[model samples]
Target: MSEPALTKRGRPGYDQRAILEVAVAAFNEFGYDATSMGVLATRLGLSKSAIYHHFSSKEELLEQALDEALDGLEGVLLEQSAQVGPVIDRLAAVLRGAVEVLTSRLPYVTLLLRVRGNTDVERAALARRRAFDRSVSALVVEARDEGSLRGDIDPRIVTRLLFGMVNSIVEWYRPEGPEDAGQLASDVLAVALDGLRVSTRSTGLDRLDHR
Candidate 1:
């Protein structure tokens, strides 16, 4: 397959990254299987050859777009915040980072979340996502072992519950919406790490007596 090469001028500043971002949005709007190269070219206001200059095929575009999504999520694990803290703190940092990545790259992450793994690219992306989950679950195990997280809950289940809440943001979150990424991240950590109900363990069940 021919790699993306810049030759003829397409839309202004229509480089590979730009094209891939637009393609991600398109794929999110119209499912990847339904989006044709011609439709993608139309979305970019460019000819088919122009898109071909960037991506060899629709599948190639899908691969790159999914890569963008996976890269954003995976990069968070390597951040200093995720690595240097106590296990629960590290988990909080990872969750916050994941939320920021999801909201900032809404279209790409949305496309990533929707993949059903029918294609090789989808399968690869799914693999990377599961690997990320395992890494985070490791933190949960550490936190549980050290008595930070609740010992009654399985570490793997805790990891899934926390991540499930984070991942669900892609369903309704919008970059242009009222809540920004950081605020949403804070709220997620607050509710996930802390109970939604009044802390009966801390204040006693008498706090519930008022309700």
Candidate 2:
């Protein structure tokens, strides 16, 4: 078997998905500061101009990848919130779908997590992330109103804790790991909503208003 050589220009040998996969891997291994279009092109077996044709800049690629993850979450929330169910049940379904996204689109979501307002693109991504968090927090508030979740903790604070734990899965999850994504989501929900014991929490918004 012979090794493949980098082809010169005109349409590039790789497709958008191929480029993104290589780019994301580079970003993951090298961090955003260290990765460059030249380096990414070299890694992907394409020329610089070829890569540029697909992406205006390295930051554009980063932004697009972040958008992919954000868009997935936005879609999940939009669809799940419309469904009829007990508030906690809806939450569990939302989380299960979120886990599916986190697993299926791990690279994109992983890149989303790594953004830290270092540049204009990163700042935009951070803003989008906050928007998503706010939306999720709204759901938590709704869940609280429905009396499906504990009311002692502030809803906004609890929302952050819930998402912090959900988002933490990217740190330890393996695509080929023994546990499936749905199972992981369920396990997470179990710990967050249920706990170690099997106490059946009921639904209704009977919480005394602290506001």
Candidate 3:
């Protein structure tokens, strides 16, 4: 395919990254099913041919966007801290890394969370998501076995509640807002890990019941 025309600044008018960014935004704003190449071209002020120059189809675009989100989450599992530390510490690293990914790629992650398996691409993304969840659940189970986490709660429930808190940030988090990614990750860990950690001393509830 012929290269896209250059702008006055001598940059390709719309590189694949730029097109993908616009496409992802549109996909997030309008459901992916509702978004078409014509809509993306109109948003880019270019011909449909220009979009095709970079991506083969809307499905290709969706696949790339979902990969952007899924790859980041999967990478967290491969991090040194996640792979090498104590199980509870590894779980904490995974949680903190996920918050980083979500905040850094808010649009992509938001689209990922909204996926419902309508297309083959969506189903593939869902499979990867399930795999990621299973990895997390395994870590939770390991931590509980190590006596770092409470034994009563099911590991699967812990995985869901932990990510539920992380995933919900998409609804309200803003890049321009006061809390940066670090603060947000810290706050999530503080609340989630503090409650989740096995207590060394009597709890407030234990004291109240005793009184």
Show how many residue pairs clash in every candidate, following the order shown. Answer: 0, 1, 0
Q: Which model, 1 or 2, shows the larger TM-score? A: 1
Q: Candidate 3 on 1-211: residue-level lDDT in tens?
A: 2356696567668778888889999999988989989999999888898789889999999999999999999999999999997899999999999999999999999999999999899999999999999999999999999999998988899999999999999999999898889989998999998855657665546556557
Would you list the rank order by TM-score, best first? 3, 1, 2
Across residues 139-180, which tens digit of lDDT does each residue of candidate 2 receive?
788888998888899988887788788888889888988978
What is the per-residue lDDT of model 1 for residues 28-49, given as tens digits with 9 covering 90 to 100?
8878888999998898778999
Which portions of model 3 miss their true places by more than 4 Å?
Answer: 1-12, 196-211
- Model 2, CA-based lDDT: 0.80
Native-structure RMSD, model 3: 5.1
lDDT winner between candidates 2 and 3:
3
Indicate the residue-level lDDT of 153 in model 1. Answer: 85
Question: How far is each candidate from the true structure, as Cα RMSD in Å?
Answer: 4.5, 8.3, 5.1
Off by over 4 Å in 1: 1-13, 200-211
Candidate that beats the other on lDDT, 1 or 2, i.e. the better one: 1
Q: How well does each candidate superpose onto the true structure, as a TM-score?
A: 0.88, 0.84, 0.88
Instruction: Give, for candidate 3, the lowest lDDT window spanning 10 residues.
Output: 201-210
